[model samples]
Target: MIEIKNLKKVYAGATVVNVPQLEIKKGESIGLVGNNGAGKTTLFRMILDLIRPESGEVLSNGYNVAGAEAWKNYTASYLDEGFLIDYLTPEEYFYFIGGLHQQNRAQVDETLLGLTDFFNGEILKKGKYIRDLSKGNQCKVGVGSCLLQKPELLMLDEPFANIDPSTQFRLKNILKTENKNNGVTTIVSSHDLNHVTDVCDRILLMEKGVIIKDIATSSSTLSELEEYFGVGQIVTPEIKVDKEENH
Candidate 1:
């Protein structure tokens, strides 16, 4: 459903993202994990057409994302709190997004009802603007808005970073259900290895603007990633590592 070809981005004479080629199929769940400056967010921005690539292109459903508006109809993304309207209350923000998708207030409320448990009783009717909420609560708002869209392709960046453990677990279940049951093409970039591994069927390890490893999630996927990041005691040989040069 998505394809990247020779995509590259540079700033201040340094290359930040340099993907040669990548493809994501419909209903696939992909996890992107990397340390600081790994270009995860940069790659996401290019895919979303928030930023133009210096070279190459990103395609969504056979159309170049840089020049197409059709993809936006089915794609939903939340990269950070910046995606939120800080001045608007959560309800108002959600309703506005719903309107953008031609959903009425009743429809938005019905969709939100499904997220009651995911919200953990902290998101709705809070009476405060989105900016006033805690970082974790703000994250909940961002993700909740994405779900309200019922998108075919969902992209979230560092979705588990600031949320409490309970919320993180709920979010993982939501993502898994979206992928498995709803057949959403989901791409999540996260630093939390366990959550990403549990939610995604494939994992991409990036570093220095390069995709150093792309491994199908397996029983040993988490261990392999931890080993690569030097957080595990043993490396699992079962995990395949696609080096940057091979790309």
Candidate 2:
């Protein structure tokens, strides 16, 4: 279970995030969406303990995130590329994260069997560095590394950004399986409305550093979401100008 109360953040004299109260129940998959500077990443950072909030507290499983070490044990996050070890090979990175979670090499190997496709023959290569890999491949490694621990609370930010279409589909399947089968509490932040709509049980929309809408996927349709986002209809050819004719 995750509990948030009065969360707020200010940078350089401007408030970037403010949440009076929010509670995410165990085994729930929540999607967060917001415009570029709307504080989605900031809130995730605070929840992951990467940044301290100006006020308020975040609790995971009855332990305050900033104050309790035990609370962090059950949480795993992939907020950015920094979580990855640039010098380690993909296999080595997996082993390192597994070891940190007290799992042995055999256990790690077993866990990674399902993700071998993501490795694309890079798993056993000993000398290759993570930093040298493509951005999409690096993201795959980061995601696989985070899942090595089988965390109770998983937080991901823009997970599909750099991935290809096929890989993106695979990732969506993996996340859905993890949430449905293991009941892992998952929070995903992405700008792709369709991606979020497909898997999220609930969606929270943020604007100007505050949550402006919160609705369940079952209760809302994609069109409804587009409307809620306040964007007008998709412009068709009839509405678009003919550049050559205008010139």
Candidate 3:
């Protein structure tokens, strides 16, 4: 569970993020969707206490997230590759992260067993540093590291990006299972409407740093979002060549 009240962030005389009041309950799967410069990432950073808010604060359970270290025990986030220790191999990096949560090497290895499908046989024993792996593989490592903690709160930014379609579906199953079976409070941000709707029970539509729409997933939700996105949108034409030209 998380709470935000009058949260605001300003940069160069511009207000980037402004959330009036929001509360996510335990076992809720929430998704944030917005275009570029929409402040989704900013909101996430504020929640993680990575950025200082100009006005209000984020609270995890009953404790303030910014000043208290208690939330770290129950929180795990993977916003980007920066979260990974690039110099370390994926195995090393995972063990290191697991250690922080009081997980020994064997425990960490056991936890990794469930994640083998997500790893797709390319992650473990690859003998390659995380930085040397492809972007998608690196993403797998980051996600695996987060899940290893088994935190009460899990936050991921653009989790499906760069991952292949098959792997994306697998990741969705993992998140959904964790939320349903373990009651993990999950929050994720993505640009793909279909994917977000499929994974999250609730979705928030953001624009210009404001949460313009918050709705539970339904039969009509996707259509509503598609309609809204299509409004005021223009399609620029691209040059095309005939099939016979090459021949």
Best by lDDT: 1
Clashing pairs in 2: none
- Cα RMSD for candidate 1? 4.1
Ranked by TM-score, top first? 1, 3, 2
In model 3, where do residues sit more than 4 Å from their true spots? 233-247
Model 3, range 10-66, lDDT digits (tens) per residue?
999998888877878999999998888889999999999999999998989978988
Worst window of 10 by summed lDDT in candidate 2: 238-247
TM-score of 1: 0.93
What TM-scores do the predictions have? 0.93, 0.90, 0.93
lDDT per residue as tens, model 1, 19-59: 88898899989999988888999999999999998999999
lDDT of 3: 0.87
Candidate 1 stretches with Cα past 4 Å from truth are 231-247
TM-score head-to-head 1 vs 2, winner:
1
Full candidate order by lDDT, most accurate first: 1, 3, 2
User: Candidate 2: where is the Cα deviation over 4 Å?
Assistant: 120-127, 230-247
Residue 176, candidate 2: alpha-carbon lDDT: 93
Top candidate (TM-score): 1
